[model samples]
Target: MRDFMDYVLTAFHHKTGWNVDNSYASLTTTANNLLDFNVPHGLSLHVSSLSSPNFATSYTLGSKGVVDGSLSFLYTSLGLNVTSRSSHIPLANLVRGYRHLQHLSLPKGKALNDVQDGGTSIAGDGRKDTLLYGRLYLPSSSLEALYLRRLSPNRLLRLNCVSDATLPSGGTVLALLQNDFGKYTTEYLYSTDSSLLGFRALYNFGYDPRYPLDQQHVSSRPARHPWDHQNGRLSAGAEAYFSPINKSGGISTGLRFTTLPIHTGFPYTMTLTLNPLMGNLSSSYAVKAGPNLSLCSRFDFNVYSYESDVSLGLELWQLSRPRVPEEVAWVKDLIRPGWEPKVAPEKVVPDEDVTGVLKARMTDKGKVGVVWECRLKELLVTLGAGLDLKKRDSVVGKFGLEVAYSS
Candidate 1:
């Protein structure tokens, strides 16, 4: 049954070219990634096996001689991660937001869009694509698990579980069901933590593939408008959540304008979100003005309190020219007349070329952060620092160095 569903979903995706970012919650993902810099606070080291992409270990030496270590394994569709001395680590580090793909790396030569095409296995790879995958995280004091399955081209189900000795209820579970209707998307969420129920919906003002065939008025389908090909797509959405136990509810609405992967022009994204109940309004704009530079800015305001702040972020890269002069042609072949561009063969980037990146962000409140990441001879190194201009003393609040090696 799962195999059949996966096949159907892949077929539908191929026909429509619907993208994962159409979901309501993903509207600001691009901007957030650029602006949300983690402030590293301790020495960290990570080692992995080059022979296998699935196994790795990490150690962090924090303040007061507190040290933490973890081991992780990934086999086919199953993932297991265990940590020791987690209680000794700072609670803030453990409770920070989690990114599902933080550790994911794309196979050589595979463009992000290619891998996102309905979860099909890469050609010639003997391993069959797994329709269901799960991850289990075990720490000294708590447990966490995530399971996800694809029900159809337009439907998905996810289950999340967390258990800890400190929790009053011992554990919490959350279930989420997402539906992609060609022109719109909807998601339903339930959480045991607060007896919360939520519903969210996103509707695209532009073209979308998830719309069912019966709903598309074939006879009245209009010819492509000039703007359809020249401008980006627009979408609007809202979410509402209620807690029966607390007898409380809240709602927020947002709008997004983003260029599709096929735009073949300067890429950009803009988003605006508002929470009327809290009188909070936020917006962001991110743009890739050039090949090696990108900029993002965000503004937040509270109507009730008359408070406002702005922040800016940027990413600068150092790239070397491709070694083979012929390979440079591929850059010009960005778009084919009517087909998706094929992933080019993996090229060996010159060791000295395409080396380093610098990402930094600053807020109006005088909080600033910067991170410089680069690839060394056989290791990847990252250096980061955080500062507060308002502080008379302790101007440099935190800083850290991280290094990773694979052998």
Candidate 2:
């Protein structure tokens, strides 16, 4: 068993450039054997440079033990043009077959608009800022045939701060702001011997302030304008899943409603996915009718399979929207009262309707296996071609190589 597993893993690694980023010297061979002990732990670190001055480094660590269940951590840093830097971190914990908690931290530099101007005209400032966000989740699981189970409510908390300074003649002035946002979400999930249903509700609240732009022109100039806007949103949704009937595939449908109290009307969305042939084919359709109208459909078909080792498939998607009165109202709202929305005046009418369509097709040729592996190793390689067509526009072609791997 050990030799067979090793061969499979080695083949997968070679084909997919496994561990291609990190310096392998930092990892020990024992890392491969840890999985067999029923203790799955893995770490991947990598660094790459773009051109001579831009680079990025990423680290991912995860472990799954019988007692602790699962825990994972990730960190990433990106640097470009010696002037910009950004970093983010995310962590997750799963216990008792449920996702229990997650945390995310993202810190970014000032807007890079200043870099475009040739000289440091006090505009292309790249200052660093830090932010942290976190969430906790609870899930329900059935213990035995006699007892029922229920999941606890979930909670999320987020905090972020921005500290940036401008280089001005007056002196260094600290421009700093902090804000806290939080939400509580509860979900009821139900499943019988063969079907599933779920409903969820969420409440959210948050606030943040915007700062005035700094003026660098020495002479007398109007003080930078300070504008602030605060807002909140509330949402709820329900979903149902049905098992396949006979040889036909399953079905799932969902609806979501959202409201922005300050805004006029509530917005809602509906989605549905159906598999007619329990075989290797599926179709999905969705329509969003609210402030805007959008229609979308997609079809997927699996063409061939080889000993569960390789597979080939094709997919197509179509999206379309019709011009309507709401769109005209939206455009008018953007312009001064007397000034009409810019267009061929003859073509600019309140009731005029426009139609737009977008279509895409993707085909997967074939895949070769055993490219590389160390733990749970799999490697798949294939060639894919795509075409994107838009109404009243030139069609675009896309060609690329597809490599897939998993452990």
Maximum-TM-score candidate: 1
* Deviation from truth (RMSD, Å), model 1: 9.9
lDDT of 1 by residue, 329-351 (tens): 65567654664343333222333
lDDT per model vs. reference: 0.59, 0.23
Please write out the lDDT profile of model 2 over residues 74-150, one tens digit for every residue. 11122222311111100000000101011111111133222212222334334221111111111211111111111
| After superposition, candidate 1 runs with Cα above 4 Å error | 1-19, 49-65, 75-140, 210-230, 261-265, 321-352
Report how far residue 8 has shifted in candidate 1, in Å: 23
- Backbone clashes in model 1, listed as residue pairs: 182-210, 182-211, 320-354
Candidate 2 segments whose C-alpha is farther than 4 A from its true place:
1-153, 158-377, 380-386, 390-394
**What TM-score, over all chains together, does every model reach?**
0.70, 0.18
How badly does each model clash, as a count of residue pairs?
A: 3, 12
Supply candidate 1's per-residue lDDT for 138. Answer: 33
lDDT of residue 168 for candidate 2: 25
